[model samples]
Target: MTRVALMVAVMAVAAQIAIPLPFSPIPFTLQVLGVVLAGFLLGPRYGATAMVVYLLVGAVGVPVFANFRGGFDELVGPSGGYLLSYPFAALLAGLAAGAAANSPRGRALAVSFGWGCAALAVIYALGATQLAVVTQLPASVAVAQGVLPFVVFDLVKIGLAAAVATAAAPAIASSRA
Candidate 1:
């Protein structure tokens, strides 16, 4: 659909804002924001589908990943777990958004934030596990290097995503109607 394609394009643009860390292979990027937004806007099935399409697009060397780098290599690299977690994360977040539909704005925001945090937890778990496996590092080391550094930033991103989603979902739904 047009909206799904637009979200895929949004994710591609988000990947452009990458900041590589010195000690970690995972770079800071707005890809998570795009993921959260897709979930909040499109609901579970379509949100997850958008992520799958995005992954497929990147896997075929579309340069949609961070730093404009993409390929199957990106999906199997140290950061691959996080990359692969997108669909699940979007599904979880979309469920939260759907549950909060037609609720008061404050309640909707609360639900979005809670689910968004859960989604981030999914990303961290999958990402760290993969980082440890691919890089042959200890799990603690992987968590230390990969998950810890990003927590604060990701929390902020979740908050922002929740706010934006709560505010915009109604408008998006209306346009659909």
Candidate 2:
């Protein structure tokens, strides 16, 4: 519980690093990296809980969301879908990491990386679908606006998350030992 709280706090802080990108409202934030880290560290259930707590905090006007914006209005705004997907993405990533936890080192790394990619895909799919509905745009146009612009950065985030998880697994195991 303490670990989950800590992760939620960390993700809340991470959500504030908004770069305000020129082309899109999404901005270049480190929230996804934090989300992935939470998943890797806490596993699916606790990680998803952390993300939910983070979202709730923001929803209640804690200013813990992207660009330091918060409130119920933010939850229903254009970026709401992306924000809402955080817990699911963390859950998916955690499931992937947990499944790989008992595998060989190489296989574990592959699984972790693959799972990270899968999480990203799920996030984008949800975001694109919601964006299309919210903006009344076609799915392709929504993807072009929401997903295409962020692919490179998201891929980088996945790699970094995988590397961190790979390195930390041994420490986690030894500490348990």
Candidate 3:
């Protein structure tokens, strides 16, 4: 639990470094990658807790969110819903991956990657819905602007996270022996 909290804090701080985009309000961030990795490594409860802590820290004015901007106002702003949904995303990913880990034919990499994709989809769904509601944009436009642009990058992140998680699992299991 402590380890997970520490990892989340570190990731949240890391996410503050943003690559500002040309037109989108969504900047390129390491947060999604971190969230996926948390799910893959920490299991469901810890992963969700980590994400919740991350959100809480940001909400408390830690300036640890994307773009180095964090406050209560940000939590209630246009991007708030996405931020809020992060714990659920991580929880779903972790649950899926954890379930897969119990199967004889399950490869951790494949399972983690698959779950990461699902998590990303959930995030996009929540984000797009909130964006449409807040901005009064059509759903198609919201998806185009908020979701499409990030898909490829997110997939790359998922793949990387899965690989890392897969490679680490045996070591982790062995260490406990």
Indicate the residue-level lDDT of 134 in model 3: 78
Off by over 4 Å in 2: 174-177
lDDT of each: 0.91, 0.83, 0.79
Per-residue accuracy of model 1 over 34-96 as CA lDDT, tens digit each: 998889888888899999999999999999999999999999999999999999999998997
Error of 2 at 170 (Å): 2.0
Q: Over the stretch 1-177, how does candidate 3's per-residue lDDT look in tens digits? A: 676877678677658766876755667787778887787777778888999988888989988788878899877766777787789888987875556667455565677778889999888898878877777889998888778888898899889888887777776557546
- Residue 126 error for model 1, in Å? 0.7
Full candidate order by lDDT, most accurate first? 1, 2, 3
Question: Could you tell me how far off, in angstroms, the CA of residue 23 lies in candidate 1 after the best superposition?
Answer: 1.0
**Candidate 2 lDDT over residue span 95-145, tens digit each:** 866677878878887888888888888888887777788888888888888
lDDT of 3 at 114: 82
* Estimated TM-score for each candidate: 0.96, 0.93, 0.90
Best by TM-score: 1
The number of residue pairs in model 2 that clash at the backbone is: 0
RMSD, each candidate, Å?
1.1, 1.5, 1.9
Order the candidate numbers by TM-score, best to worst. Answer: 1, 2, 3
